[model samples]
Target: MKRIFIILSLILVSAAAVSLNSCKARDKNVIRIGLNAPITGDIPKVGEGAKFAAQLWLEDIKKAGGIEVGGKKYPVELIIEDNETKAESAVKASTKLITQDDVMIIIGPFASKQAVPAGGVANNYKTPMVAPWSTNPDTTKNRPYVFRACFLDPFQGPVVANFIKDEFKFKKAAVLFDVASDYPKGLAEFFKLAWEKNNGPGSVVAYESFTTNDKDFSSQLTKIIKSGAQILFVPQYYNEVALIVKQAKELGWKGTIAGSDSWGSAETVKLCGSDCFGKFFSTHYAAAGAKGDTKEFIERYNKKYGYVPDDVSALTWDSLNITKKAIESTGGLTGDIKKDRTAVRDALAKIKKFKGITGEMTYTDSGDPQKCAVIVKINNKGEFEFYKSVCP
Candidate 1:
């Protein structure tokens, strides 16, 4: 009787262990993707766009019965954490996503200010992160795990410089940027280098700056106009873009204004109104005259969201799809988070060419994509029209 009792206890213990292991295995059957966006801060519109686009992508994944890997389908979930558009906030958000959420991959913190800091956390944690619209080179510089969906400022700077020189025939240029911010500051320097190389040394007549959240630009505009600048290049977000452009015009500065991808937001023209009409800016894609898949995305987003999608939205969509491709290309998940994340990162690095709705991207060693930049003209209707394409 004693022997039989002992045997029954051992059998029950073995059954319990098996049940526990089975539960653990079942827990690993779902893939979690993290999103760290500025959902409630300075650029809430950017955050809104990222969230909306991600949800749209998630819908597609669900429709296909989740993402398939190695002939097995794993249900996917998105863990969204708002970064609030601050550098420190981004770091904390990314850390939580990696350590607590245990996400396979992270996407967003769109602006360079947030993306740069968040990237460090992701890289240190050995998690893959993709920034949808961060154009600063430092966002991916020396960080193998960090990647961006947009062109770097090094490429964008020269593109803007050459465009202004060739199209407008402008020899003297003025630049107004936010010194406190990384994106504008870096692009300002690069543009200056490119402009001086194309024209002559000291060709940039005026280089003025302001800290973030400064509404008045009369002081900078005054200096720029006094410097005999024929064009004013403002590489700032939509909020600052409208203020700078309007304040410049109000101050009796009559030179053409040009912008960078930051101006591609729908709020730019809306805030600046007729003041922003007939301006040109360098961006990822133009929504006014899109075709094929690009047009389809824009139409669907507009119908569902009640507004035209911006470059950030398009890039986020592309980034998620790229993430999906990389995850699917991992052959199979080992039910180990670390191993699977490494596999996804490796697959992403090996992806040389990907056709995105924005453009075709060829990944480089540093994980930056070789893609073309589009010059968009803000027409009379405040619509972003495709003007020209510049390639690297």
Candidate 2:
């Protein structure tokens, strides 16, 4: 009886050891990255763009036989969590990705509203996170572990303000933005400051505001038209762009309508139609006449998705590649999630220059890129065409 009991105990111990070894092997063989996106709420298109871009990147990774790090290749797995376009959900997603999913890095919650809060969670957990489309300064401000793939609103705001002043020689401007949203509200303020600085105080004739989900802008339009503003700047998402532009025109406003990077989505023209044509906006890239890698990416994405991929998609692609470069630059992972996260974060901070499909980026310790912004015009055919380049 003692011999039988001894044999059973040995068998159980060996089985336990095998299971433990298998778990360790699994962890070492695959790299997990988290994607926190608004897949279902106000901006599903943004999430779709992000997801499609990541998938295309994964296909390239597979073709290369996985990502090579320290002379060895490891497969990558993306754990996508929908933030539902809410700040609370974004925080929850970040927490889950870091604590439960054990993701080595995180990407997205692209909007500043979500990215800002999610960034705090990722920073607290010491995980590296990159926001590809967020332009708000707070998204990466003082967060060592958080970085962004796009320029900050402080830069973008002035770019647009100066563009309007130079292009149209306009002295008076009007601003209409979503007061409840972080990206628009923050960007609107920056633009207002820049405009006023150049044209003196009170140059922004009609600084109007609206909350999110407020479709009717007739009251704001009436005020703007009466304000004698030369141009109206609406720093809003694609969905709201169409409504604002169409409504402004319907109200007999003759002034030009301009926008910010939020107008980079393909849906902007699709939804706005003729109302958006001949309008200019500041964006990350221009797809109508792109060359080299940018052209190739646009072609591939359009062929697969049946529409030109927007700046969001292009930025997301670049961000994923940047993440991959950071991972490989680490030489190898130590199989410890915490140690690996720190290594990747350090590697990312050290990347001096990265040529992305959108543009070239030079990183500093602040985690924001020093790059130029593109001024894009919606041509007669509803295509986003490159108008001018503004550098800081």
Candidate 3:
């Protein structure tokens, strides 16, 4: 009889253990956020910063006991994919995240060329996406599921043009753009129109183009130099920017070189060496003298990592927080992932005033962030110094 009782108690204990595990599993739920980055191609730093920033954001969320939705707290899970800095690769990565991984939100492929194609694939599944660095206007066009954290090329281009024309009095400007890249090409086009309109017609001294694989910029820089341009604007990536600066300096071109946010990487200085000093670029934020949330983020990132966070890092951090806010605004994820996803999309669209580490952003109805741009100068120390802020 005692043996029979012992067997029954053992059976009860086993059943109770299984029940406890089931309850714990329900309590320790998770929501996956997909990150598509160009972690292997020409501009790997962009992706590296983004991935690091997401990890930092996740750490904070975990400390806070995860993101609360519908009164249930869920630990945020990040699933990162390498896009290889190409549009086709971005499409493949984003498709996998949407279909196979079943992530609710996806953050970035850095540039517009990749973001546009990735955003298209995300649109089909009604998945929410926030591109931290993409500036091309076409990225969010007619796509409600897609959003960006940076100012559009049109918005930022005029800021750079007006700053040079109004503040620096640089009337004669020239442009060197990558013909194959959408961000640089669109920024160049916008800058040209704004320069001519704000400064004067024919103010742009020369317009030059290059491809992404082109290493020899001497041919293009020679034309820009011969045009007697006081300000040479090269709205290209940091890799190409470094080459352009090195080649231009080697050619004895003494003009003030300016560029877009793509020039915000530390690789610019490391690649161009001493030639990159004192140049200027328009970006989302300047970390060296940042204040408020920006200051706090830079300090924390530096403490955890070995270096300071750049524009892309801050944007990626903000995008992750923005996604978290959207998830929470939906009252937590519902059992129906489809309905909850739509709710998250709707919540994101309604975010008009979002104060982030970068700056205060007001999202327009079209999914663009209505924010200002900051011009940063590379000091003699190869550090980004906050020069000035331009608001629209």
- Which segments of candidate 3 are over 4 A away from where they belong? 1-28
Model 2's TM-score against the true structure: 0.94
Structural RMSD, model 2: 2.8
If both were scored by TM-score, which would come out higher, candidate 2 or candidate 3?
Answer: 2
Model 1, global lDDT: 0.92
| Candidates ranked by TM-score | 2, 1, 3
Question: For each candidate, what TM-score against the reference?
Answer: 0.94, 0.94, 0.91
Model 3, CA-based lDDT:
0.88
Per-candidate clashes come to 0, 0, 3
Candidate 3, 290: how far from true, in Å? Answer: 0.9
lDDT of 2 by residue, 26-79 (tens): 466789999998899998999999999898998999889888999999999999
* Cα lDDT of model 3 by residue, 69-96, tens digit: 8888887788999999999999999998
For candidate 1, lDDT tens digit of each residue in 177-279?
9999999999999999999999999999999999999998898899999999999989999999998888998899888999899999999988999999988
Candidates 1 and 2: which is better by TM-score? 2
Output the lDDT of residue 60, model 1. 91
